[model samples]
Structure formats: C-alpha cells, structure tokens
Target: MQAQTMQAQTMQHKRCMATVNKSRSMMRTYLSDEGVPLSYSRKRRIAMNLLKEYIREKYSSNEEIQEKLLETLSVYFNQVDNILQKTESPIEKTMAIELLNLIKSDSELGEIGFVDLEPQKTIKLNNRNKYYVADFLITWKPTVSVNGVERKLIVECDGHDFHEKTKEQVKKGKLRDRKLFLEGYTVFHFTGSEIYEDVSGCAIEVLEMIRSWHLSWVHG
Candidate 1:
C-alpha cells in the first residue's frame, strides 16, 4: 500500500509540473508580444521573476536547469537593451548615462535621489487621444526629515533638432511643460548643448536642487 501511495504522489507531481511548464510557455508568449501594453523593462522584470520562482520550486536540485534559465534571462535582457538603445538619440543617451553614473557614484546624493529614464507618465488630453513622455523622472526623499517630504521631478533632455528646431515645436514643448507643471511635477529642461558641454555641471545643478528641497523639509 505504501508503494502504491508513493507512485500516486509521483504521478500527481508530474502532472503539476506539466501544467506549470505550459503556463510558463503561455506567459512568455504574452510577454514577448509587442502589443502587450507594458514597458520592455517592466515586462522583462516580470518574466524574470516568474522564471526565478518556477526554478526555485521545480529545479532546486538541478544545476543544469539553473544554467539554462540564466541563458534565457540573458537573451531577454539583451532584447530589452536593444529596444532602449533604438529609442534615444546618441547625444541624449550619452548624457543620461553620464548623469546616472554621477548620481549613483555620489554617496550622499545617491541616498536621496532615485532616477528612472524614459518612464511613462500618461496625461489624458482633452481629445483623449494624446499624451506626453517625460525624458527622466526622479524621486527625491529627504533623509533628515521625519515628516516624509518628497519631490517628483521631471527632467527633459531636449535635443536641438527635435525640441527647438521650429517655433511651433518650441511652443508645443512649452505647452507640455505647462501641463506637467499643472499635474504637480517639477519640470527641468536641459538642452543637449548644455549637457554635452558640461554633463557633470548639469548633474551638480540637479543635485543642488535636491539638497535645497531636503534642507527645506528638514527645517520646516
């Protein structure tokens, strides 16, 4: 009877494993679809976590499974990186990389400043068919304050060809800025020329703004 019970349990486990694999395959197909309405990074992270939990449950004793999972994850990450690379201009991308590196490398500044690039913020237009994308979004938390004061910042790295090429483009940019300001985001614009000329200086300016806000929160 014990041997029969063990065999039954084994059969049930195999069935469960098959179901899990089928579910994972379906999830991968959904995530890989371009029309899934999720950012590449977000989708990649979700897929990675799903795989991680599945491996932990089913492949805890198997090194080969772990290796294969890592290989698959690497491919997903490369695809996401390629998508991001194609989305930005060379100069703007360089500036963003430099600024992020500078912010992360600073001990104190890094503690308070959290940065995300090309994060989507959906604003409903009157026509209900339009929205704006902010270049960078930063969340600043003041460490010295017990009152939990924070700031949401939008940083726009404007390219000359795209943002300021014509009067109408410039006007549209201002309108977008006003809309964001109305929505309670502190928007700062940095031209590509300024970023290229002094990337560190631009970072310093942003850091200074964060510091000022922190001090205000601390004293108030």
Candidate 2:
C-alpha cells in the first residue's frame, strides 16, 4: 500500500508538471506578441514585424514559473495544516479559513476531517467577487435551542481605528453587514474594547444566537 501511494504521488507530480508546462507556453505566447509602443510614421510596418520578432525571441516554452507556483502551494498547504494542529486560538483558525481550500492534503493519511455545518464561511460571490472573513464562527447544535435553526455571526476585533474614525468605521461596517445580509449571513460585529469590557456579555450574546437557532429548528 505504501509503495502504491508513493507511485500515485509521483504520477500526480508528473501530471502537474505537464499542466504547468502547457500553461506557461500559452502565457508566453500571449505576453510576447500582445503589443508595443510605436512611432507615428513607421507604426504600421514595424508593428507586425516587431510583434513577430518579439514572439519568436521572448517566448520560451518553459515550466519554471508553473513549477514554482505548484511548489509554493504545496509548501503553504503543508504549513497551514501544521499551524492548524499547533494553534488553539480562534483568530488563527479564522485566518486559516480565510486562506480557503487552496491547501491540498492526502485524505488517506488523515490529513483532512469532516467539518460539521457551522457558521457561514468566507464564501465568494461571483457578482461582487467579495466575501467576509470574520474572526470567529459559531453554530447551534440541535440540542441547544436559541436564535433560529442556524445563525451566522461576524466578530471584528476593533482597534484604535474603530474609536478614532468612529462614525466612518461604523458606516462602513454597517454597509459591509448589509452586504453580508444580502449574501444570506447574519453578522454581529463587536469591538475589542467591548469584548474586554463585557466578556461575559459577549459570550451570552453568542450563546443566545445558538439557542435561538436551535429553538427555530425545533418549532419548524
């Protein structure tokens, strides 16, 4: 089994290399003959000739960049898994989620686990191509009845900016929350000071949302 796994990995690496090469070749072709600044009078004659020459000389069929990107991705994924296992903080975990599923791992080795349906994630919207990356996510387990069936929350660790530019930041945050609502996620933002001042209160609010979700699920 170990031997077969190694063989499969090797085959995958080779296929990745081939794909990298093909993409690199195509990019070079596009970049090389795309365009050039030209003199007014000699523009017509030189443009096509220069473009052809540029394409021929500058375009090299190489997989160097592709190979580098693949290598970097592999390294990042490995590091991300390492960090996830090592850290206990909610903030770190949130950052990892923000990075998304670009990280790849071998499932057979137990590198991945099932994630239960929890708070919404930083989902991309094709229309705006934007998503929220909150500091923490919570869910309502069926047993704990509170806000509704499921509720999503966004917690922002507000800094000095939140106080200094209070009005502006609040406006922007509300706008962001509005966008999140439109995207089907409930957002609850809190400042760092608020958390520090009323840690228990913050905890209660989170629990209340969970219970609310649970109760909704029960009633419906």
lDDT per model, in order? Answer: 0.62, 0.45
lDDT of 1: 0.62
Best by lDDT: 1
> Across residues 46-141, which tens digit of lDDT does each residue of candidate 2 receive?
433443343334333535644454464445444444544543343333333332221122221122222132232456644886765554454323
Clashing pairs in 1: none
Residues 116-143, candidate 1, lDDT per residue (tens digit)? 4343344454544777766666677655
**N/CA/C clash count, model 1:** 0
Index of the highest-TM-score prediction: 1
Tell me the deviation in Å of residue 117 in model 2. Answer: 10
Candidate 2 Cα outliers beyond 4 Å, as residue runs: 1-121, 141-150, 161-168
